[model samples]
Target: MMKWACHRPLALVLGMAGLAFGAPGAEATESGASLYLLGSGGPGTAVMPPLEGLYFDKMVWVYDGSAEANRRIPVNGNITLGLDTTIVADFTTLLAVPSTNFLGGTLAVGVTMPLGAPIIDAEGLLTGPAGGTTLTGSLHDSALTTGDPVVLTQLGWQADKLHIQLSTMTNVPIGHYRESGLANLSLHRWAVDGSLALSWHDPESGWDISAKAGYTANGDNRDSGYDSGDEIHIEGAIEKALSPKFSLGIQGYYQKQVSDDRGMLGPFRGEVVAVGATAATTVMMAGVPATFRGRIMEEIDTTNRLEGTSFWLDFTVPIHMNMPAG
Candidate 1:
């Protein structure tokens, strides 16, 4: 079946820059609750589920679709963030370092750059200090945000029936940010993420199951005066290979805010659960290897977080395997 150098595209959504408040079911705030989950890699993404660890190079792509509204907290009316008019993409390359093997395992590192074409539609009541309220029309703000780059490092070990990996992904705060705006692409904060995954594969039987979980620690946004909360996410999948080149499976994710938002927001928590389907395949191109994976997710349960559908397409092409050693 096809093998994927698992990577989460949600990490590329930039930081929680503008568009603070989440939908009704979602946690709305000016802190880290908007989205991005502090750049923590989501489930089915923190680790690769291959029977053998890959020591080659690869390039990846990703996309997300969603929309939400927030109103309960502010009586009159709330702000809504529609992602249908927003487009976010990530481009990354994973490279295997020469002699990166430890004992019998392999080590790899990758970097990701993100681009965003955002359409943030915001409208609600604005209350001034004089207790006067002004109703503003819906704002359809658009901006192209160049997101901060992400660095990912992984250590993987594989056996006959099981594979395990440890990973760390860090988000650098180098994207665009505006303290005042309907929406922004950059979170304007630093984040360090970690994950571990284990997978069991039986090639002869065409059965595979894998699970991964991750945690995130975030830095405070100076301009926004907000300290986003820490978060934990988990993902897992079960599948069967129909042929040497194809596989189909079920995948799901669960995320929760572990700590409370500080500095500018109260102690609030948000959580979400989603389940989806996935298909994977491998094809040869001009004697080169490429893999394609497609997935669709629907949120089943959510609190303080938006409930929406997300879809993604991943393409990985190996560039170079290894360098000559002295």
Candidate 2:
């Protein structure tokens, strides 16, 4: 069953009993909307890592890069699309607002933009009526390159050793997309998501853990006449601080369709699970504090979705990290 996944697209023409029929469920997986589910639990997940109340008067810049690869993805009974050129490079900028009356917390405003795509290669085996075929090819298509831009707004509350937040992410559909394209980076529809996140810290041992859960409400793709499904995603991480400037941890995420995919074909579901390790460190440049984080993840299980590995490097630098201490 080829579900139009980012990792698989049965482009081959397979037949049963002399009847030519492409694979079933040849729908496009939620590549455009699925990017939001990559979050992993870690410190300050409940809020922008460096844009919390205590960090007021500061702005942060973040860069993320990731790639996914899958071998022999089934497209149909006789065809397959191999995925190799999957990569996403994203940039985000965030600013922290001072304390507010609501939840006695702070507000964070940010914008995240991604420049990349999902499908990179394709190989196929076409079975004809004569039952003889050997086929192969490669493709490089980046879904993220045409995907919409995301806006983030969240309220964060920090108390002693506890941190909590409520956030919303909105994706604007105004990127490159073709209704019939084998692979695309744009959803061509709006997606609004809400999330709750939490972080706990132990001052003495410098141990910490965090988690974030979110739900997505998607809109219809006018061009394709298809409505992607609502989705649920969870991200979490465990970490230990080696020093005030360094930390190491494990992080991961899981995502699944909550509502059946709507439109044209009507209602199909998809799911995926992934896990990875994380490492981070802080450096001072010209009296400014900067943070660098790197993570690698492996997709363990998936249904009607992409199956592959992913990794990213994140760098954050606060604009006012050089400000004088009180």
Residue-by-residue lDDT tens digits, candidate 2, 262-314: 54334556666778886767666556555666667776776655455656556
Q: What is the TM-score of each candidate against the true structure?
A: 0.78, 0.73
Collision count of model 1: 8
Model 1 accuracy (lDDT, Cα): 0.54
Poorest 10 consecutive residues by lDDT, candidate 1: 72-81
What digit string (tens of lDDT, one per residue) describes model 1 on residues 1-326? 13443322222222333232344522433322333432223323423423332333222322243445343222112223332234344444454443345666766666656565555544543433322245565566667776566676777777777778787767788877755564455666788877787777666777777777777787777775556678887777787878877878888878777887654225557677788887767788656556666777777776665455555566665555442455
lDDT for residue 182 in candidate 2, whole number 0-100: 43
Q: Global CA lDDT of candidate 2, please?
A: 0.51
Segments of candidate 2 deviating more than 4 angstroms: 1-29, 47-85, 96-103, 117-119, 123-146, 178-180, 264-266, 321-325
Clashing pairs in 1: 15-187, 16-187, 22-28, 23-69, 25-304, 26-304, 26-305, 27-304
Residue 278 lDDT in candidate 2: 69
Most TM-score-accurate candidate: 1
Model 1 residue 151 CA deviation (Å) reads 1.0
